[model samples]
Target: MYICAFMLILGLAFYFGWSAAYSAWTDMGVYAVSIMLICFGAFGTWTYYNIDKENKANAK
Candidate 1:
């Protein structure tokens, strides 16, 4: 449950940032937002994957 919330937040943040980047013509803002989105997305994904692995390990 916690993992899902985190994933959602991170995903939304990334999506909005990317959208803002696309709607604007400035390269700097786009690049910055893109970098942020990538980092957040990667971290969220990693956290979710680790949680799944942990749960499986415990089940076994």
Candidate 2:
């Protein structure tokens, strides 16, 4: 469940970042938001993967 949520956030973040880069860069607020989203998504995805790995290792 947490993994799914992070994945969704990551996906959306990429989409927004991409859009902002191509067209919305002129808007500082939108650009900043996109950048923040991308950073959050990356961190969340990385953290979740590590947690999942730990869980699997302990289960084995």
Candidate 3:
């Protein structure tokens, strides 16, 4: 979960960096890939936290 959050932050930083460095927002392919990374990172983090919570509840 922490790793996923880190990845999400990293992805966001990378996207901003790429935009600043290359001005590639006009490119759809680049946008798609970058957005995908951010989305996946967010989703993974959310899923992990929810599963962990569920497991803890079941344990009791």
Query: Best TM-score goes to which candidate?
Result: 3
Estimate the TM-score of every prediction: 0.54, 0.55, 0.77
The better candidate by lDDT, 2 or 3, is 3
Residue 1 CA error for candidate 1 (Å)? 11
Model 1 per-residue lDDT tens digits across residues 1-60: 456555556655765666676775456665576566566666777787899999999999
Across residues 1-60, which tens digit of lDDT does each residue of candidate 2 receive?
Answer: 466566557666766766666875466665566566666667776777899999999999
- TM-score comparison, 1 vs 2, better candidate: 2
Once fitted onto the true fold, the runs of candidate 2 whose alpha carbons sit more than 4 angstroms away are 1-26
Order the numbered candidates by lDDT, best leading: 3, 2, 1
lDDT of each: 0.66, 0.68, 0.84
Pick out the ten consecutive residues of candidate 1 with the lowest summed lDDT. 1-10
Residue pairs that clash (backbone atoms under 3 angstroms), model 3: none
Between candidates 1 and 3, the one scoring higher on TM-score is 3
Name the best candidate (by lDDT).
Answer: 3
Clashes of 2: 0
